[model samples]
Target: MIVGPAQQLAYVAADVARLAAAFVRESVGAAAAASTKSTPTDVVTHTDFESERLIRHELMVRCPGSTIVGEEFDDLAGKNSVGWIVDPIDGTVNFLYDLPVVSVSIAATINGQVVAGAVADILRGEVFDATLGGGARRDGEAISASSVSELGQSLVGTGFSYESTVRARQADRLVHLLPQCRDIRCMGSAALNLCWVGCGRLDAYFEKDLKPYDYAAGALIAAEARAMVDLPERNGEQFTIAAAPAIYDQLRGLVA
Candidate 1:
């Protein structure tokens, strides 16, 4: 039973909001129990695992037979084109430190393409969402990228990869970009940074080695808000640069 794009996005966003509340309940002011995933700094916490389980259970109950991929779940399972990709908690470090910047991100990808997505900023009680051919939104109001036309005047966002090698490459890229942008920020939450770009709160965003669940939903929300999307290398690795259409080319060129 295929669902219309609008209803699918709405349903996903509603579920994201519900799961976000659960995450906050388990995370806020609580002692974090974390372990390394890829390295010492790349961590995952108890809340992350619990949130993903709750979300997956609810999603499967609602859309039986649909494939689901999550940061904390088994990646081997159903292979339906209409798949759900999720990052139960995008900024585990921030959550551990009691920072108010993490989010729960979920996306529906149809045959390798993201068709609908949602990101719930649990700390802020805000949801950013979009669907293919449907304009982006926060809560219920429309949103869009900034109109900044010059890279030198644009505020930018970025994140480091869990892989040390990729993080080194990104650090190198930043050396070339830092002198060109008005300012650069590494907010620790890729999903939230992309949402900020979508809502014109940030001028642009760039990052590499991000998983599908990390950036897919926020990237779609950015594009739906009229941001330009670009990939520097098509080597099966996920590298992205998204910005308001005006300065997008300039930023993309720099990252490329």
Candidate 2:
């Protein structure tokens, strides 16, 4: 019995997330070397490469004909229309500092639409996953966004950019947004932050200058969990906003 793309990709995402989680578990607290990416604040580790390699290999072998695009490596195109977007380590700085707030994210897109995704929080051993029209789950149990209707009562999650100037601007935005919301939390991992929104750990989440590998899986999971999601416009400045339905507009307005 052959499964559909959504089902097949969901399974693949789960497996890949599990594998990456295991790698993180074994590698954490070990003496892993790190290197800078675009800036001094943007760092990568050996675990990131190893985890991406593992995911790319498994995805190619299991799916057979799907392109794999990862944060650490060049794109691997395949024959099928499906494409896998992976973030081997979503919070590398935190991981490097042993902060236990990192995650592995995977998403499958069919002809430009995300069909399925999974995000594994390595330290918590929790996995959040979703398929298009299939809702969302954390560790196999169904989940949804919070019911916080007012922005002043909502606990929002956000992230910063690697560029120094961007970080400065993000701080400025946070200053204006801080008093409007109940409080703001900046978890190092964007993927986990989005999953947190899905599981009701956060009432809302928004960030700017995110890459496809950063929010691909997480945004899908949040939307499936009944959160309102606004992805960044294509070929323009990248920004994302996901929040509970009741507070989406208020949050977007304040942040804007």
Candidate 3:
């Protein structure tokens, strides 16, 4: 079965989301185990690991030849040119606290470029999806970035670094940009923040210390919905700034 990239990606994404939601529901009665990967503030749970494993297993079954790059998984599944990127539990800390803003994100990349993506807002039952040239959608309904042309009228979102040392720099950057905007929100989930931006719920978003999986799917979804995405200025930096085209220039200037 030679499925198209976009179709295949969509299938994998939907499958992952379904499995992720089940994992979250199952964990409600499970024991809370605090585990650290690199630092204390950066937390991982049994759910995160279990969810990633489920997502991986489903992907392999659906697309046998496709490669898999996931946060919870260490090595790539295969070296196929086309692959899937997965973030089983995007907001692990939020999920741990039983917050309703977490999500599962998945993207299909061909030759290192995203071709399709989806982010499932677990608590809201919203699934934002997009294909390379196909328009973005929220649960089958089309979505687009906000039309706000002025920064004073725009509502923006951003995320903080888990590492304390880098978090100060993010806070300092926010200080210079906040006064110029209408308001700012610090959402714990990077993928959901960007998804909301795509659906016209947020005018702009920026963040630091994000991995490829965190923004890969959301970036494509926003871009397909007519939003602009910008990468961090410094090399090896994990910063990202995504916004509606109307205020992209103005907001970019504020952050830059």
Index of the highest-TM-score prediction: 2
Cα error, residue 134 of model 1, in Å, equals 0.7
Model 3, residue pairs in steric clash: none
TM-score-based ranking:
2, 3, 1
Clashing pairs in 2: none
lDDT tens digits, residue span 75-150, model 3 = 5657577888889888888777777778899888887778998888877877888889987889888999998988
List runs of model 1 lying over 4 Å from the truth. 1-3, 79-81, 231-237
Worst-scoring 10-residue span by lDDT in model 1: 230-239
Stretches off by above 4 angstroms in model 3 are: 1-3, 29-31, 232-237
lDDT of 2: 0.90
lDDT of 2 by residue, 142-226 (tens): 9999998899999999998889898898898898999999999998899999989998999999898999999999999999999
**Model 1's TM-score against the true structure:** 0.91
Model 1 CA lDDT for position 167: 80
lDDT of 3: 0.82
Which wins on TM-score, candidate 2 or candidate 3?
A: 2
